[model samples]
Target: MSKKILISIPIFILAILSPVAPIFYFGLNTKKIDANIQRLLKYSWFDELYSTDKFRHLFFANKHVRKKLSSDIYVKLLSHHKKTQEKFYRFLEKENNRSN
Candidate 1:
């Protein structure tokens, strides 16, 4: 094989695989944490650990922080998503009135 072809092949492969590593790692970690949380949800201290204000803000507290970005940003994203869903659902609701 030519040096140029060999070098380019490795570079292309590396570029394609580079992003997959972190994505796979984070995805697996998230699934494991989810299973652990679900299995432990019945226990009282598990709930307490999640509710404790002191520990809740810490990295290892309530749940495993699974985002590639900061957990705060991830939280904000989830909150926004929830609010948007509420608005969408609210639009479909009908109010009752005594008079026409």
Candidate 2:
């Protein structure tokens, strides 16, 4: 029992951390974080885990592996993504406005 508990502890920790891997991977790169997240979110598994499904039927979630996340997770992810893209998006908007 003791040995099983010890072995399972690390596995549990890894399972929790694995879903948010992209956040850790490109966190430091502000210049590319938005693009990185945009790409990662297109993957069904990753997007479901983060609960960024724009359409319910689009993301095929595996309930057996893990329950789908709540909108809170998506909200937080969107907040972070928007923060990173703010300057770039604003610049684009400004350029379009000036041209018009």
Candidate 3:
């Protein structure tokens, strides 16, 4: 009886802690994912490709497509593109005014 109680106690403790394992795993994965994303974001070619209208259309066209794009990462890329485009247009406008 004592041996059975000892085995059951460890088993019960393990069952209780099992759910926490995935949470820790995912937390570590999230950091790695974020790091990889940041590295990818630094490339100009990646920026150009992500900024295209076709990419935007495909990203928003369907659930499966959006999932493939990893919506969170794509959204952040789109936002960065938006800000960069705005800055470029502002610079162009300033240049045009100077030339006038």
Candidate 4:
């Protein structure tokens, strides 16, 4: 292969991937957090942890999660706001604790 073509191939691939990179990167991180949250939701420990103010602040800082929580049509339709808020807060704390 020519030196120029060899060099260009990787660049070309990156160029194609770059536009979608942020979405994929954020998606992966969100998935990690979501998995931890899902595990936490299965337990009762979340009930106590979510009631604190500290947890609420950090939990909402994550824009992706915030958007998901606010506009989740399924959740809105099916859940009471207070109940959903409790669940969301619990998930956030779970994900935060997992990161540490």
- The candidate scoring highest on lDDT is 4
| TM-scores, each model vs. reference | 0.33, 0.28, 0.34, 0.37
> Tell me, what's the RMSD of every candidate?
13.8, 15.9, 15.3, 9.2
Pairs in steric clash, model 3: none
lDDT tens readout by residue for model 1, 1-100: 8999999998999899898867666553555454544544455544554465543443242222323113344334433565743442232221111111
Q: What is the C-alpha lDDT of each candidate?
A: 0.45, 0.46, 0.51, 0.58
* Model 1: residues with Cα > 4 Å off, grouped in runs: 1-6, 9-20, 24-26, 29-32, 57-100
Identify the runs in model 2 with alpha carbons over 4 angstroms from their true place: 31-100
Model 3 C-alpha lDDT per residue in residues 1-100, reported as the tens digit of each score: 6999989998998899898876555433434444544554576754564466544343234333334234456535544686754554354345444545
- Checking candidate 4 for backbone clashes, the offending pairs are none
What number of backbone clashes does candidate 3 have, counting pairs of residues 3 or more apart or in separate chains? 0
Per residue, candidate 2 scores C-alpha lDDT tens digits across 1-100 of 6999999999999899998875577343332434544555775544653463333322233221112122335424544675633443343345444545
Clashes of each: 0, 0, 0, 0
- Quote the lDDT for 2 in model 4: 100
Off by over 4 Å in 3: 25-27, 39-100
Task: Kindly give the stretch of ten consecutive residues in candidate 4 with the minimal lDDT sum.
Answer: 69-78
TM-score for candidate 1, residues paired by index: 0.33
